[model samples]
Target: MHVLELAKRRKTVRKFLPDKPPKEDILKAIKAAKEAPSGMNAQPWKFVVVDDNWLKAKIREACEREEEKFYSHTKGELIAWLNAKGFKPEKPFLSEAPYLILVFGHTKAPYWLHSTWIAVGYLLLALEELGLGTVTYTPPNPKPIKELLRVPNEWKLQTILPVGYPADPKPKYERKKLEDVVSFNEF
Candidate 1:
């Protein structure tokens, strides 16, 4: 598919079908992600794929608690922004999706955070190419996730991607025009 069309069709879908995608497809997407360029070729990223129901439940529980606190405590512009997106504290997709990809970055590395995010972008495209849908999620706190997932202390949990075949319809969103987002060499 053309890059433009692929990007245009791609959407962040929260609802999903219960069917699990093939493991090979998941690995292929991860392989593409790992190919992303990193600072000094450090490739300071790790992906944890979670498919277990029990573990997903645990994650959902912890995340919901944090979200409750976040919604209650956070106010003003942030709340308005969330409301505009139709976002709520509830997150059932975490447990409902067939796969949960946990992206981790090496904390000690200078550009690990940026590199990992770059990889995540690649992963999103790859998944879309494979006819899968995902929503990138960032939990309120990492401590619970680290403890529950047994993540190494040196690695920081960055993003969570709930993967599955989409159950929801495509949402219409208005994006800023190219002119509004891009600036010439001299800003």
Candidate 2:
């Protein structure tokens, strides 16, 4: 499928089937992600693929704790929007998905955060191409998860992607028009 079509079709999958996807397919998506450009060729991104049920449970618990804190503090339209979207503090998808890809960026690298996010975009599209589904989930606080996963201090957590076949029906949302976001060399 065309890249734009694939992008349009790719939706954030919160509910996932229990079946695990092939490791080879996951690797292929990672390979595509590696092809993304990095600042000064540092390639300062690390992807940890977790499939262990125990680890997933631990991660889910940590995430839920942080999410609860976040929901309590955040207010106004953001909270209302989250509620309208059916998002709650409990993140069942974290444990329910067959796999979790934890993306990290080396803090010392130049433009590491930006470069890493570009790579993640590549990963998302690649997974879509391979018929897998995921959501870009970032906990309000990542320090506990970093320790739980034994990630080095130099590597900062970016996002967690829960991977599997989507169990929920796809949601339809509209995107902003190209003209609304574009510029003719001037604001």
Candidate 3:
């Protein structure tokens, strides 16, 4: 499929089937991710693929704790939207998905965060092409998760992607009109 179509078809999969995806397919997506451009060619991203049930459970517990704190303090439109979408402090996907791809960025690299996110975008699309599902889940505080994953201090946690075959059908979401977000030269 075309890249744009792949992008459009890729949705945030909250519920996933229990079946595990092939390791080679996940590696293939990572292969695509590594090709993304980075600042000064300093490919400063690291992807940790987790498939252990015990580790996934620990990760889920840590994420839920942070999410609880976040939900307690946050208010307004974002919370309302999340509530409308049936989201909660509990992060079941962490344990339910067959695999978790933990993305990290080396803090010392210039534009590390930006570069890492670009790579994540590439990963998401590649996974979509390979018929896998995932959602970008960023913990409110990554310190605990970092320690749990045994990630080095120099590597900052970017996001966690819970991957599997989607359990539910993809829902259609509307996007803003291109003209509404576009301009000719000046704002």
Ranking by lDDT: 2, 3, 1
Q: lDDT values of the candidates?
A: 0.92, 0.94, 0.94
Candidate 2, residues 116-148: lDDT per residue as tens digits? 999999999999999999999998999999999
Model 2: lowest-lDDT 10 consecutive positions: 166-175
In angstroms, give how far residue 113 of model 3 lies from its true place: 0.8
**Candidate 1, superposed: residue stretches over 4 Å from native:** none
Two-way lDDT contest, 1 vs 2, winner: 2
Q: Give me the runs in candidate 2 sitting further than 4 Å from their true place.
A: none
TM-scores, all candidates, are 0.95, 0.97, 0.96
* Model 3 misplaced regions, further than 4 Å: none
